[model samples]
Target: MAGTAPGAITVALVDDYDVVVVGVATMLEPYRDRVVVAELDTNEPVKDVVDIALYDSFAQPESDHHEVKTLIDNPHARRVVMYTANFHPDLVAMAQDLGVDGYLSKALNARELVEALESVHAGERVISTPPSKTFANSGDWPGRSEGLTHRESEILALITQGKSNAEVVALTYLKPNTVKSYIRGLYRKIDVESRTQAVLWGVRHGFLPDHRRIDHWRGGP
Candidate 1:
């Protein structure tokens, strides 16, 4: 990868959902001078040579998945960072073993997130502290407008992907009962009463993963 401009670290935000990347992009807008979002890719490869490729693990597989390795091997991304709410010790270790430059928590505020990216760009391996259960979620997800919390939205997204309760437990590392509770909560918020109804509502409300990329910053042509 080529060098970035002085005083700015170029970034490629990666996720499977358009809303996920867009939310992170919006959060970084105020700090554009320090972090230039060079690309916003949804289920697409990072085509530009950027200082950092920040992979948001929203409604997607965790760092243990092959997706993380793909980002690490991408010649276009000088460094790859895992930006996720999951900080399981095993997952962090897996990401480190996969050669991720950083493992950041989603609880970080905008300023802290930018600083962490800067640290990674400076060739440091960074890992954030686990967030308290009371910490508010930082970025957006698919069903936030309809009152779904990040976890609830994730459950719905996985459900839309046809994951059973047990599968959700495995993928999210959540207890089976917790997954059931989230599903129940999301069902009420979305005005659905059954799994079929929730899936229908999720499909209509953008729960599916996207398949394109935004090469420019913030809608530039």
Candidate 2:
């Protein structure tokens, strides 16, 4: 459902950790109509050459000149943005010195993130998140049921993406039992005893069944 507008920004979420990559991809799913989150990365140049490439620092530990330079050299990523959790001033400056178009932290919420990307797309240098928050965290998403909790909505979102319990654990970075427990609670709250039923409910409420989104890390060139 990525955008088709002629001026729509094409971007790639590049991270070594598959789970981080998937998590970011999931976070951006609702904005498909505004930006094209291109499926990229391969031996060949990525098919949908992107306007920006968001390099998650979890995948890249260091902000060295050569590291940023390599990303800048990627043909598919015309502009490089160090999308990371690290905000140490020295590291940020080092990255910027290496021609990174934007140095964005993972602390920004989804709305702030899209705004930063849009600003970057418009040729602006965005380097800070809103003053209030210092880390990326999920919202208290209310579910369709009156008693459903935020964690339930989170689990429901993952389930609707066609993720198995194991995949959900990987994406959420949660323990196996913890994920199962959340699933069990969500199942009860959603009034669904089976995965299929839960998925159906999610679909009815606007969550698309994504059988292949799990492979988004491998989707690039």
Candidate 3:
């Protein structure tokens, strides 16, 4: 691997939603001098060599999944960082055991986020302080325009992927009743009376994961 430009750590922002990664890229814009965002990938592999591959867990699997391992195994990514709101003790321990360089909280401000990346790049393990409540919704997701919260949209996305409520509970670590509540709320927002209808609505909308990459050097996609 090649060294990054002096005084700037090359980074790749990875997520399943364009708006999610784009939002993170926009947040890091001011610190371009310290952190050069080389790529914004949506459900795609990182194509460029970078100091850090910041995997944003936005409506995607948590850090314990194979996705994190994929990033870690990529030769182009010098280090892998999990940028997620899920800070359960088991999840944190699992990420650390999986050899992630950093486990960051989405509640971090831009400056804090940059500093954590820098620390990881400098050969130190880092983890941010977990938020008291759920992390605030910062970026976009499917059904946001239809009054669905991020969590609800996440549930609907899983449903659109053909995951049953039990599977959703397993994947999301949400209580069974909580999952049901989200499904009910999601159905109400989309005006669907049945799961099949909700799935159809999600399919018509943008619940599916995207497959594209945005290169910052040549300008974003």
Clash number by candidate, in order: 0, 5, 0
Clashes of 1: 0
Residue-wise C-alpha lDDT for candidate 1, range 70-144, written one tens digit per residue: 777667789999998887788888888999999999999999999999999999999999877633557788988
What's the ranking of the predictions by TM-score, best on top?
A: 1, 3, 2
**Candidate 3 runs further than 4 Å off:** 1-6, 40-47, 134-137, 212-221
- Write down the RMSD of all candidates, one decimal each: 4.4, 9.2, 4.7
lDDT of each: 0.81, 0.65, 0.78
Q: Candidate 1 regions off by >4 Å?
A: 1-5, 40-46, 133-137, 212-221
User: What's the lDDT of the predicted structure labeled candidate 1?
Assistant: 0.81
TM-scores for every candidate against the unseen true structure: 0.88, 0.57, 0.84
Clash pairs detected, candidate 2: 40-220, 40-221, 41-220, 41-221, 42-221
Better of 1 and 3 by lDDT: 1
Summarize candidate 2's per-residue lDDT along 1-221 as a digit string, tens digits: 24356777777876544445667777777876666677653354455567888876542335344555666776757788877655656777787778788988666788778888999888898887524453436322325334655445556766776878877665545579988898888887768889999989877764543222213333333
Q: Model 2 off-target regions past 4 Å?
A: 1-6, 41-45, 129-221
Model 1 TM-score on a 0 to 1 scale: 0.88
Candidates 1 and 3: which is better by TM-score?
1
lDDT of 3 by residue, 31-142 (tens): 8889887754434444567889888876667734677777777777899999877777888888899999999987787888889999999999998888666544555567
For candidate 1, the per-residue lDDT at 179 reads 87
Which whole-number lDDT from 0 to 100 does residue 34 have in model 1? 90
Measured by TM-score, the strongest candidate is: 1
Residue 171 Cα positional deviation in candidate 1, in Å, after optimal superposition: 1.2
